[model samples]
Target: MEKQFVLMDVDRNVYEVDRVLNAQTTNIRSFGSEWSIRLQRLHGGLSDGVDVVWVDNGCTRLAILPTRGMGIWKANVAGVPLEWHSPVQRPVHPTFVDQSRRGGIGWLDGFNELICRCGLGWHGAPGTDVTRDADGNVVSEQFLPLHGRIANLPAHSVTVEISDDGAISIVGVVDEAGMFGGHLRLTAQLTTYVGSNTFEIRDTVQNLSAGSAEAEMLYHCNIGRPFVGEGAKLHIAAAEVAPRDSRAAEGISDWPTYTGPVQGYAEQVYFVRPLTADDGRALAVLAAPEGDRAVAVRFDTSTLPWFAQWKNTQAEADGYVTGLEPCSSFPNLRSFERQQNRVVQLDPMGSVTFEFAVTVVSAADDVSRLVQEVADLQQAERMTVHDQPNPEWSP
Candidate 1:
């Protein structure tokens, strides 16, 4: 039987304990491995009032934040940390974040999670978003903030599930709606198994409005040392790769490779069309310098057709990290993405789901196996590397 715990239900007016854990009182625990689940709220600084849920499956531990759109704050798989050091040092509360600050790029103030969703309504660079009627008369015009409001919105309801066979799931529901804006609900679930070095995220975004609504999402999966250092590499099967701008074009020849932290290295982003398996599953890996440890993200091209690789190898204090992003559209201005025909339009009460799995391998043998698999997929087709940004894919 699958045991369930209701953490929060707005409609039911239920708000459980401030903290919960698996103990003798509950009489339910995973048998072999040391498994546990805890829910707590932060009390100080920027993290104040943030609701955090922790799940430890013996081999893997995940910290999830329902206050941050059910995003995974961080993860540790088989003793390998899957997170980066961001200048924003805490799990910031949404109240402290002004999405419109700093010229629409203020989303960086709360972007420290290892895996953060970038959309519910729209996820891209901030700009004036205008919608016009069939005859070109403007219907709506407004400035959209950076990355949308999903990342900073709190979940209205959350539930924790434990299966008799030792599977753990944390599900949360967050709605992005307002007066002029339509309603978009995000149902996110994070699942893992006891003693396993893997976890999966399943997110479903639904349009709860009477009229059609625009939708876009990007999974920004970030990592740092020891998975991103000198000699480390990003292993992915890409049929084509292009720089996002001229700055990124400078390093196009060595796009997939990495170097240790530099004092003044600027960030570079590459847009890619990844080669996928027959099943539409695409993979991206960040290997450590020693090649014995690695973290991999498995996604589907059928749901997420675009990929963005962000490399920011600046000094540690400046937030040295890299991002392996999978998205429905490129992270450009919403207007540009719409011009490129990359946004999703959801009908009334319609929904679409996105799913991905993360795995960590510490054994050299296992890492080598994944490396070889990525290489094989890469070689299946001749890759086209654009020296400069592709006008078709970038603004």
Candidate 2:
């Protein structure tokens, strides 16, 4: 039998768990065989009123924040840290994240997370989103902020599930609703096993309104330092590779390679159409400088069909990190992505599922195998590496 704890159920007025896991512990007899789950309320600083759920499964550690869209703030696998050094050093409460600030890019203030989900309404570049009458005259226009509002919204319902077998799951539901924005609910679950080097994030975005709705999502899996410094490489099997702009064109020749932090290096992004396996699985890996260790992402392309390699190797003080993003579409503005047929449409009360797994390779042998897997997928198709930006894929 499995034990379930409700951490927050807004409709039922159940707000806190108050250290329930501390009172009830679980144990096994192999591979370190221990798991500890803790829920803590942060006080003071920018994290005021924030709730964090920590799941330490012997070999791995996860910091999941329900207050900030149920994002996994950071994680550790087999003693190796899988996180970037963002300017925001802590898990910022939604109250501190101002999406409308900075002319629109204010989302960067709370941008540091191992897996920060973007979108529920619109996850794309900031721009003017317009709607027109049947005859094409503009009816309404608004400035859509960057990456939507899911990451800055709190989950209304959260639960922790622990099976007698020692597996762990953290479930959260974040709602994006307003008089003007309609209603969309994101039911997310993060699951892992004791002493395992892998974990999975499963999300189902639902339309909770009486009418149809639009949704977008991207998993911004950011990594830095040990897994992303000099000599690092990004492995992916893509049928097409394109630079986002002229700036990214400068590095198109060495798209998969990385260098140490440079003081004035501007950010560059490459959009890829990864080739999916027969099972609809897409793989991307970021290998360490030594090539003996790495982190891999396996996603189902039936839902997330685009991949973005975000290169921001700026100085350490300025936040040096890279992102291996698996997304439903490129990070172009919502209007632009919709024109490219990238935005997803949902019927009333309909939903879509996005599933992906993150695994860390602690051994040199496993790293080689994963890299080979990417190569095998690529060889099946002729890859088109565009020297400059692909206007069709970029804004």
lDDT of 1 by residue, 1-395 (tens): 98888888889998775656564545786468888778788899999999888888899989999999998898888777888889998899999998889999889899999999999788878999887778989888889888888999999999988888888898999999998779999999999988899999899999999999889999999998789899999999989999999999999999999989999999999999999987778999888899899898899788898899999999999999999999999998887888788999899999989988999999889899998889888888988999999999987
Between which residue pairs do clashes occur in model 2? none
Model 2: per-residue lDDT, tens digit, 151-239?
99999999888776667889999999999779999999999987889999999999999999889999999999889889999999999
Root-mean-square deviation of every model: 1.4, 1.8
Model 1 ranges with Cα > 4 A deviation: 135-137
Q: What is the TM-score of each candidate against the true structure?
A: 0.97, 0.96
Report the Cα lDDT for candidate 1. 0.89
Instruction: Please give the TM-score that candidate 1 achieves against the real structure.
Output: 0.97
